[model samples]
Target: MRSDRDQVGRRIVLAEDGVLLREGLTGLLHRFGHQVVAAVGDTDALQQAVAEHGPDMVITDVRMPPGYTDEGLRAALSVRRVRPGLAVLVLSQYVEQTYAARLLESDGAGLGYLLKDRIGDIEEFAAAVRQVAAGATVVDPEVIRQLLRRRRESSPLERLSPREREVLALMAQGRSNSAIAEALAVSEAAVTKHIGNLFTKLDLPPADTDHRRVLAVLAYLRGG
Candidate 1:
């Protein structure tokens, strides 16, 4: 793993409704060598900060003031509309399949959704920030597990072989074929074969640019 200093100096805009957490995150970002160009506490202010600063990344809580029902996530989505390809990392206290699905509906590049509990691991949190800024997708493992559990009873994913299911779960964690193979103690060719089979079973079409792995993960989350 690269040190946080390896990806230093990224400009970030942070949005969190809680004052203490916001301050703590701001300090943490600084300690990790990134600049918090703006740190706001509400959806409106968050959008304003992103628009005004045009930060490299936006780190926001899933809920925020003024309804607090996914306002922060909504605001992040809106920012993406205006600034396509902008990196966003949403933090949530719990896994919400709807929220995760909505965020992953399009290309998953430059997107991340993580549990707030991950903040306890500073190195991991910093790594997620760097990954998002570098145009990689990152989703919490627990989020994937929760989504799978919720749809386990009648999910099309049930059609998958155990190894295929394992491959899909690793894909949901944003692992590449090589990484998944290494984790599973299999050859890259085997991992690719499993991924191809899973894509066929899931009925995902190949795209020129969009990642099939991300689409497969989205399909899994949607219970397809």
Candidate 2:
């Protein structure tokens, strides 16, 4: 729950083909102090809304339009290419790691992938919107689980210890070091060590400090 003290209302453009879900989401976001500038039903309308509103963030369903396959996801990728730093939170009915990984290929900040049916708590959903709007990564836990399972035996991720894997999974979820530490009930120093170990095990050489986590996640997504 957000209080007046730290409330950050974001202007959002919502794209969900289902009329009920789109309206419901708009109302829910409104109740939490977010302004849904536009609620659209298809990829074309979604793109138009983004162009017209220039929202702080975009919340879109995976399947949409006449094809109803991945038009929404593709349009999202396209819009991001044009807008660069625009925040995107993809909501899908199933876990589709391929498209998810493609979306993550760019900067990982302000990116989120979530399953529609899996979001049970309204508060957490709202919090996820806020996080993504503020340039944080927020992936579904189910996505993380299935993503980890796809790693092949020959993959470099096979070298990770169980604890290190846990740290890596949480890292992919965009949890900060302190947040991962608290979630694992360990010291922050322990989480740092686990992250360093994962970096070495994954063969990620020293690079831009801000993007190291994103590189590590890309490695995990590439199943190695």
Candidate 3:
């Protein structure tokens, strides 16, 4: 829907350890009208690909070869250092709040963190690619769940009313005002009021609602 007519096919590099998935995702991206400049199986190859191709986007797995613990995150951080505008989409099978925190700590522009399970909805997932390319941060709902679960062990969130916590959790799930309202049996106006209150208490920057919601979720998890 939001495809850039002038830049419909941005260059991309993919890094994933799973051979089958790596190839499959490359094919999907090609079908969506993007150029797969390079696809590799490990972080080393990822670094090399970035150095050689200078792709506009890097779709990498959170776990990759050579100490598959956080190699992808490390590679992403490295690329951000060299090319701040490069969009990155990180895929993972598990939700790790620490990885999310680290990724968003400095810069969140043109970033996406999604789970492998979400690959089923090809259309929606492709939309996420467009969103990230347009400089939006797309975080998966499961990652938000991890962030909220990590938040409950803190003070401010611990002090929030049960209803407020419910709203906060749903917000982290990337739900829009109307969606959250329907889920909570409230009006859209009521959802907006709760969001305002939450942002005020959390001391988050008043920006676009979606980005502000992301800041709130990140702040909650970081216990700021």
lDDT of each: 0.88, 0.87, 0.84
Candidate 3: residue pairs that collide: none
What total of clashing residue pairs does each candidate reach?
A: 0, 0, 0
Question: Which portions of model 2 show Cα errors greater than 4 Å?
Answer: 1-6, 153-224
User: lDDT tens digits, residues 24-70, model 3?
Assistant: 99999999889999989999899999999988889899988778898
Worst 10 residues of 2 by lDDT: 1-10
- Residue-level lDDT of model 2, residues 42-134, one tens digit each, is 999999999999988899999998898889889887888888889999999999988787777876589999889755688789888888888
Assess the local accuracy of residue 86 in candidate 3 as a C-alpha lDDT between 0 and 100.
92
- Which portions of model 1 miss their true places by more than 4 Å? 1-6, 156-224
Model 1: per-residue Cα lDDT over 135-170, one tens digit each? 889999998887777668456687789999999998
Q: Candidate 1 has what TM-score?
A: 0.67
The candidate with the higher TM-score, 1 or 2, is: 1
Q: Is candidate 2 or candidate 3 better by lDDT?
A: 2
Best model per lDDT: 1
